[model samples]
Target chain A: MNAILSDYFLPCLWASLASAGFGLIFNIHGRGLTICAFGAGLGWLVYLLALDAWGQDIFAAFLAAIVCGFYSEIMARLRRCPVTGYLLVALLPLVPGAGVYYAMQYCVQGENERFLTTLLHTFGMAAALSVGAMLVTSVLRALLPKFHRAIH
Target chain B: MNDDKLLALGAELGRRLMSSGAEIYRVEESVIRLLRAYGAEPQVFAVPSCLFISLSAPDEPAVMRMCRIPAHGTDIELLEQCNCLCRELCRNPIPVEEAFEQVTHLEDRCRKHNPAVVLFGYWMTTAFFALFFGGTLPDCLSAGLCGLAVGLCALFGTRITGSNIFFRTTVHAALVSAFAFLLLRAGVAQNLEAVTIGSLMVLVPGVALTNAMREIMAGDIFSGLNRTAEVILVATAIALGTALPLILGQYI
Candidate 1:
């Protein structure tokens, strides 16, 4: 239990704080900032859980991104605002910043093989993240009107 | 209805939406909806850099307007306000003049964070991201310092960084990597990777990558390709920028 808390919960907290800070830079205010930060925490939590289950970082990112997309879409519908800000801010934690760094390090050290591997892994991570989030967005866009009609 | 003013208003609002970092479809859809609400059938096209709108009504001359949007940063508050105003206008038809004034002055009403607060935001982001990436407390502090430098450059170094987005991102990434190296050498930071990655988070093109994918999926293949190219350029610039510092550090 303690290990889970330290490993998963702590990182989620950090991700939330980081996202909130990024929200400020993006000029998000008040409740919108909170939503973005919360979404970030939620997405990171899901990512961690999925990582533990599958042991595939890209697949975990894809799962986490789908959750974030749903959260952003629901929040946008409630607030009648664009989903771009929330989605963009929340996904910051999962973006492959470290991959870019490692790739650069390897290239600088003249390790072509590792550089190519890291580069491909980074691209795969990005593609998975995009595909996951966009899948939710596209499906929701098609079905949301029916859902709204049903609710009414 | 004065067709000239109505068309101008539509074009202006669409330009504002584009400049505020709205997606391509949103800008086009919003303008078309707004014009239709005012009894005009409008056609709108928007890319990342420019917007085109052409409308023809029965009695008035066909007017087409094109506006080139300036380089912009994300301002979510402005975007929200613009979207809300557009929706309100569509719900209740308003005088084009009054609506135009409101759309132009939208930025005046929304509160803006002061520079100090934004700098603090930069510090907090890098610090927390360092911790999230498994850095120690000291490493987090150093990363925060590097973040501060990056924020300063982003906010006030436009003259030095210039207008080229690629050059600006490269400069920011290089600054972060160099700062991380110096801090590591000075014994202020233990985890070079943690500090550097945390600082580089601010420069990553995650937004563009996501936006590109969204545009393609939404059927704006042109805009999607444009943003994808931007993502690739920025990624290459980052790799080059960070590599410079590492290569130089080897000699020192």
Candidate 2:
């Protein structure tokens, strides 16, 4: 556990700080960074948790969608550029491009079940990330009126 | 003063931009305009930043950006004059990041990247492949990763190359596709995860999303489209490049 924590823990923290710093340097400010960092860290941590609990690659594509939701809403208020940047970067880890590719590979190889699973996961992750981003943006907008002007 | 230092400083400024929650587009344009004033267009690969205006030559054929006094703090009017200089620069045809003191404007933004953010992407791709097609790929059919890696490399290459974005995206995907295929023939399975992540990292519509939201809020679809289309194309190239080898395997 120490080894695992050592390996994952520091990096996750750095990811938070670095991504936070990136947000700050980019002109993101106030509770906006706080919110963005929380979401970014949550995404990183949730993935770590999923990795540990399930081992390797189980339900990650789907859960990553959840993180994207959180990331988009929080970043939308703070960064204020548009939905694409945060939505894309936030969903970076979850994009199922390879999943779709492998599904095709499996289809060619005659594995129907495997192909379907891969296909479902890819679409599921994509849908989830996009919708999640939209949904989160709406929620953050509605709930957090304070960050409105900050929205670029 | 060194070009490398300015570049590094530019990167750090990018990190600060990220941290500040500033519109990376606004910051990048501001920086680009300022650098162009001094006659240097920075070639920094700021995806988060590039999500706004593209890293392309302006239609005006002149550079644009503002600059303030170095040692003395700048007043708002000085900024206006700097903006004036940037307007003129944008009107002239000068190389972007090399026309002036590149780092002086936005030297506060760069920071380290999370390797996990990098690794997770590649790992996600690799695992997705294995989960579905592990049996088909011999004991170690790592070549799929090479294909993905080249896809990403192409995206990064597009940014710095002085070509039009569509051309840059296509060239990047094509070059990386060829590289991935060659690596496979050589039996060298370089971390397909890293390559795919790095290259794809370049094309992700980060700027589009940012600009899309900003434009819509400001009620400017025309400006947003200018940003969005490039992002979508880059993504298309990535998807096509990554899938090419997998698709071709059927015919071969």
Candidate 3:
């Protein structure tokens, strides 16, 4: 894990910085910085883990979103701030900008299967991440609205 | 002077007003208005409250809390008497000012590094170098540098360009293809992969990946998935562009 973290040094550094920038806009306070940064770091980890799990350079991206949401709530409550700061930062890693582009290139070249599979996977991963965040938040709200409300 | 304090003040306000019965949208608008009143151009979106982020100046401030604040009065009162509410609500105007100043300072920094120059310059240069000298460097260094260039450009591109997915991907891919083609003509003493590595740098959507994860965590599957596709597309485009020239090289 350390090795993988150390490997993509620049991406990690920039992503962290970007997360910090995000923190400022959303008015993330106290632990919000930590929460935001964790999301960013872990988001990158999604790609690394996906590569290890699937043996391809993919981002299993759902985890990145889910983790970001879970942490955003946890951190927001802890810090008594909003979740926007952390969520945006955490989201830095799973944008699928590269995936969508490649899929198009493949399609343009008439490589249908590669395009379809890659495109589907990217979209699926994104869908999973988004749904996960909503589920966690709704569950959190249902399970402990009082605790969650205290943060804001 | 610091960004944290302003954010803290805003957060405190958010926390304090949660019990006052304001919808999240009202609070968001109020906050954005406050930021704007102070001359900071904070972007305030009314989408998922979970994603309420601002790109006002140099730094993007994030929303940390999720509590709802009650509007002080009805629409008739608020719309008719904003000045009264403004004075009544703001306890610590200093924090708002400080935050505005900090963001303005940041906005200045962003303006200094024009996206057109940075994106275009890096795109052309990375490709030119990869084509001319790709064989001379180590594989890791080549890929790393290329990645650095593209990653950096994404930051500016996100800000300068319109917020459209298709536009962003198309520009990124087209640039990568242009650079890859240039490298092909240079005929450097490198294999296809090495050259590909160089051009591939401009296409990594590192930010998108992180954002997707964040959305998922925020529990917005539709948004999270949409974003993931965008980031992945960028990477694929870079790879394909560099590879295309190689395959065609055999014929040429």
Best by lDDT: 1
lDDT of 2 by residue, B16-128 (tens): 34333333354455556544444445643233323221222445343222222111111212222233334444566344344344324433222322444343333333323
Pick the winner on TM-score between candidates 1 and 3: 1
Identify the runs in model 1 with alpha carbons over 4 angstroms from their true place: A146-152
Candidate 3 CAPRI assessment class: incorrect
Q: Lowest-lDDT window of 10 residues in candidate 2 chain B?
A: B67-76
Shift of residue A10 alpha carbon in model 3, Å: 12
Best candidate (score: TM-score): 1
Best by DockQ: 1
lDDT of each: 0.91, 0.45, 0.49
lDDT of 2 at B179: 52
Least lDDT summed over 10 consecutive residues: which range in candidate 1 chain B? B55-64
Tens digits of per-residue lDDT, candidate 1, B1-252, equal 677898889988888888888999989988998999999888888889999888887876788888999888888998888888988898888888899899889889788999999999999999999999999999999999999999999999999999899999999999999999999999999999899999889889988998998899899999999999999999888988888888899999
Candidate 1 chain A lowest-lDDT run of ten: A143-152
Over B1-252, each residue of candidate 3 has an lDDT whose tens digit, in order, gives: 344544544444433332222234435556665554445555544322232434335555453333333322111112212322333334335556554443333313221224443444344434333432223444333433443445464555667544554555455544444444454456532444444434443344544554455555655566667656765555554455445544565577
Q: Which candidate model has the greater lDDT, 1 or 3?
A: 1
